[model samples]
Target: MSKEDTSLRFRQFEADDAPVVYSFCLQLIFKQSCWQLRKKTMLNRGWMISAVTASVLLAIGLSWPVTLITSLLCTYLLIWISHTAYSYYLRHNRYQDLCSTAAFVARWCSGGQDRLFVATLEDGTVIASSGIVHQDIDTCELVRVATEESYQRKGVGRALMKYVLRQSTSFGYKTVVLKTSDVQTEAQRLYETSGFSLSKIYTVGRGIMTVYYYKLNLTDH
Candidate 1:
């Protein structure tokens, strides 16, 4: 597909789109979950919390002017460090059964929020895929948002996501939510720029992994 073809034709999925969609889903999930990315993001987030506390305590003994400067510096450092750390650690590996969090949309799309969509070229080559699941009457879940490895950052992923958000709004879901890993920084940007807010952060395996939840309000859409 032309990289400049910002108008990639999108439509509902078909039985034949299954294998390719599954391959893209797994590849992105596994590749982004690489330990190298996790280790890089985890660098000293635990330490920054301690540093922030220490700075506040250390300020107790200083002159007023110095104390003010120190507190500001500490707070700035804390926010900066924490943001960097989190930006790296929000990756998710939630793919489970056909109906799991990262459920393969091809075979698992059952209707409601589970409806799936795919992006294709005019010649019928599939290049991207995404889906939404209804968490409840008021909330929808986004999942399996993936693009061919070679197609990353060419505007395909963002198109698929915006499409999903529109679908969520159309289906009566007021909010759309999804979990993503810490290292998926680019994906997070897409979500945030699309009006999704960070709703919560969950850690499992005693901090071995951190998962982030993001939500987009579709009410005003």
Candidate 2:
């Protein structure tokens, strides 16, 4: 082909690539939009709590110095309570189906044979999810399987767990480990159903943690 014709063809190819680049840009923008919306929702929930706390502190500021200090302290305490309540409400509202403390631990034990698994939801809503990496007594692994809370009880977590286990087997890991707080009894039950068993009990901060360890036989992998 003539040099000019060849250069023209290359230019056409580059021009045709525009749509792919544009689509990627659009995808990135939508993802960012989702994150911003979630943040705004969280901030709105926090606003009322912050306003009430500020008002209480302002009211106390009118009193004598000692009383004012006491009032401010009380206001801060109230603010803290409000923040906690708001967070609980958000989680409860957002993730109703995620198994409770015990279930998560059980799943961990059942799948704890892999050295690593990536855990997370398909979408980017909940960050504190299965894709998290945990270091058991001997192995370090990723928890790549997780289901959205809204889809729990419908076999979402189970499916994700199974997928992760398979992936772990393919990845050539021998075992995986996980822990769930005993407070989550429902989660504990779920884990049992998923073939996980309780392995040990430990403590973190003020909460008693249940550790479930699961080993995948690589021969079957």
Candidate 3:
């Protein structure tokens, strides 16, 4: 752990931590979703079309004010479209099902073989958390690896990951697998650095979302 994280402590998840954990997870999901939507919107072909149209208007000797107004209108339209699409997706997507309720989240890590570890400050504020659930006799699945935005890059997440992996090894698991979205670049980096290899890439939501699957062989570690 880095010096910044020296005051942090790790422990098993407790019932009272459900609310905080759920809220944090939900916020992270929303933040990621919004970022992906914004990126896609900016990269969308609609922007090129708008730019071409504006250039054509200018080439045809249209007034600068007219071209400027047209461009601004197009930009506003794109923003509106992006916001509307994001709202609709949030309402209908399975992301909500993952953390639909604090109770559900609590029960997810309540299984006998499931382990959820939380890293907290001296005041008990959870800054990071991760979980592992048995997948089979020889494998386990990692879930909910997240760190508060403000506390990232301070070794909190890496420390929590180490603890989770150690606990998985202690449980006699031979392998650990995890899934993360392609947009979660930081998480992918962390997993790769922690010895996880990319096992697969698949899309869901009719190709709207891309997910990466990773696995680490505990025996090798």
How badly does each model clash, as a count of residue pairs?
12, 30, 0
**TM-score, every prediction:** 0.67, 0.38, 0.75
lDDT on C-alpha atoms for all candidate structures: 0.70, 0.41, 0.78
Top-lDDT structure, candidate number: 3
Q: Write the per-residue lDDT of candidate 3 for residues 36-128, one digit (tens) a residue.
A: 655665565447757876898899999988997887678757766766676557645744434456554655555678778899998989888
Top model by TM-score, which number?
3
Alpha-carbon shift of residue 61 in model 1 (angstroms)? 50
Q: Model 1 segments beyond 4 Å from truth?
A: 1-6, 35-94, 97-106, 109-113
**Which residue runs does candidate 3 get wrong by more than 4 Å?**
1-4, 48-101, 204-208
lDDT of model 2 at residue 8?
A: 15
The total of clashing pairs for model 3 equals: 0
Candidate 2, residue 30: Cα displacement in angstroms equals 25
lDDT order of candidates, top first: 3, 1, 2
